[model samples]
Target: MTTIPVTDLLGSLRSGNSTAPRLTWYGPDSERVELSGRVLDNWVAKTSNLLQDELDAEPGMRLRLALPAHWKALVWALAGWQVGLETVLDGGPADFLATDDPAGAVEQHDAVIAVALPALAMRWTGELPAGCFDYAADVRSHGDVFMPHSDPDPSACAVRTQEGRIIRHRELISGFALPHTEGARLHIPADKGLESALANALGAWQQDGSVVLTHPDVALTGKLLADERIHGS
Candidate 1:
């Protein structure tokens, strides 16, 4: 698939080839959830719709992301990028933000989105600030397909890295490790950050591969690999 621009990768996932397993995330408790490219795209769409309809996310908007290395974080990251917003990972200034602690970030950003990190949490049981919006509750009611009013510039800034420098989608896409085209199943250590997770999953998807994500507690042995039919780590 062509991946010069970042949206091309998203386009391929949405329509070009949507039925394959694109990402499989595992929690620390051994719980797992496999998302096909279509399902993943649907999540991105819902998140994008929420960001746009509720938070006024638009091209060039600054979005601060304070999420952990979890599956929902991936959805937020992709959705933010899909809306042509700059992801501020360094806790810098932004127009909108996503964090577990919405109270702290609400003062800085226009709207604060609170994401419950628990695997099966339908909503946050903790007491949230009055202005905070639950990501789980808000995202579920949005549309499943994203149809942008205008295509964003591929050369536009996509992310502000930890070092506080802007990076484009093409630059990020070029850094991936694209392998063969077979449906390769990968088993990965689950301790990596959200950034690493995105890179690893994107690299694997470039090869038409799936993943078997797990925490360190889950020992990855050959027997386990054979049982899961995983081809790589």
Candidate 2:
């Protein structure tokens, strides 16, 4: 398998099917959020800009995601990769942390981002800890396009798993363990956890495919499967 750079994969997503929905989320309370390729790229760009501009993130640094397997978490993972930050999924020391619990995360890291998981959240509902950035509030103010200060080193670590496994940037695509389904719409259950969901989503996107990610509480009904044109779980 050919190794596709994370940067190139993101570019392909933006240019290949700019208007089609690449990631579709089905959450509790009948919530459905769909992000077209262009929109998804814009979100990622804004997030990458935020990480670079606001957080002063650099390549080879670590950004730990204390978030669940939600759409926003997926976006954060992609953005972290775009910024060349080693995305840490484990509870290890990191330069920055993105979490739903701002107060708790602030205690662990100096630079913390409070991420709201709700689809329509404009900002964190409550008061954030001192110095903790509000993801929903701050992300929109960033630029829609991102220009990284430096290219990621392919040999540098890209992801650190909870099980203490490391995956390098060059190995991210080629080393993806999921079964590839070309141009297929895959259904990913959120119950499998963040790392699995991220891997599955990456695998789907790499093949010019799409994903229908469902929250744990959301049932995968027959109508949803048919409506989403899901090829596999």
Candidate 3:
């Protein structure tokens, strides 16, 4: 299979089919949110900017993502890769942490980013700890276009998995083990955990395909399959 570099994959998403929905989310209470390629890129750029500018994140720094398998979590992973932070999915020690529970994540990281998972959350619902950065509140203030201070080192570690595997930046696409479905709208179940979700999403996006991510509580019925035009799972 032909593989594109992680950065190049993101570039294609932004420039190739900017208006088409790249990610569709289905949550509880019949809540649905969709992000087109351009919008997804914009969100990633904003988050990347926030990481780089606000947190002083640089290449090789570890970013432990304590988020669930949701749209926002995917955005955080993509942004971390964009800014060259080593994404840690093992709940291990790291330079920074992006999580829904800031109070629980405060002890081990240099900084903590509180994430609000609701589709329309303008800010964190509760009062955050004194030093925590509220993702919803601070991300919008950053630039939509991300200009990295320096190019990422391809040899640097990109992902540190729970099973103690390390995937380097250059290997992310080529080493991706998921089945590829070109131009297919794939459905990814959230119960598979964040790493699997991220891997599947990356494979879909790499092939100019899209993903419909369903929250664990959202059942995958025939109606949903037909409505989302899902071709694969």
Candidate 4:
């Protein structure tokens, strides 16, 4: 039996040695979910194809997404990771300009070759700093196949936190502990499995991405997840 590090899972596929797929996200419907299944040899194979067809052809090879802190953005984020690209998660149009310099700060830390922001943010009627692309319509022009230019490298995942500076995959993996409950390991999207209350709780807790605290007086478990804003504050 071999133990695998979750952080290295993406890297394994890029190396063309691993075939097992991992479900990185659930869906809004809870049932109609988005998962990174091993439908091919690896994720990089799919990402590479998509990059070559759509993303790479776009104005900038780099992208910044200004979307809500919902699962859709998470899907986009993971896609960016698969292609070894940089992502700037913005809180939408309201914070667009205010975030522009902050976003530039992120780009300064790394060379942001292209931009991948949501349509709403790009067309917020505010002045764009120049050279920004509309990801919504542009992405549709490309096919769904993900073709990576290179293999997945664990060291490649670079994300910007609100606190300041950059954080890499290596640093991210060592910082957290997995929850012991079954619910903490698997995450069921909010609308999914509503009938299966226990299952929903199990999924949420298993993922360890959510914080489900209890209100003894209310006798209910409150769940929290990472979104555009901080979770479990």
User: What is the C-alpha local distance difference test score of each model?
Assistant: 0.74, 0.89, 0.89, 0.35
After superposition, the stretches of candidate 3 with alpha carbons farther than 4 Å from their true spots are 1-4
lDDT digits (tens) for residues 1-233 of candidate 1: 22335466667776756887777776656677878888988988999989888787787788887877667877888888888788778778888878876766666668888998776788987788878889877788899877775566667778887776777766656643334446677766757665666666667666667666676566777887786787645
* Lowest lDDT block of 10, candidate 1: 172-181
Flag regions of model 4 displaced more than 4 Å.
1-52, 57-62, 90-145, 176-233
Per-residue CA lDDT of model 2 for 11-30, tens digit only, reads: 89899978998999999999
* Tens-place lDDT digits, model 3, residues 7-73: 7888999999889999999998899999999999999999999999999999889999998899999
User: After best superposition, candidate 2 residue 105: deviation in angstroms?
Assistant: 2.4
Better of 1 and 4 by lDDT: 1
User: For model 3, how many clashes?
Assistant: 0
Instruction: For candidate 4, write residues 1-233 as lDDT tens digits.
Output: 11113324334433432332223332222322223334322333433344455334221134354433333343444455455554443221111111222334333322222333232333334433344433333444454445444544445434454333454534433332223342232433333221122223223423433322211122212332342122332
Q: What is the C-alpha RMSD of each candidate to the true structure, in Å?
A: 3.0, 2.2, 2.6, 11.0
Shift of residue 225 alpha carbon in model 1, Å? 2.7
Ranking by TM-score: 2, 3, 1, 4
Candidate 1: stretches off by over 4 Å: 1-4, 176-183, 216-224
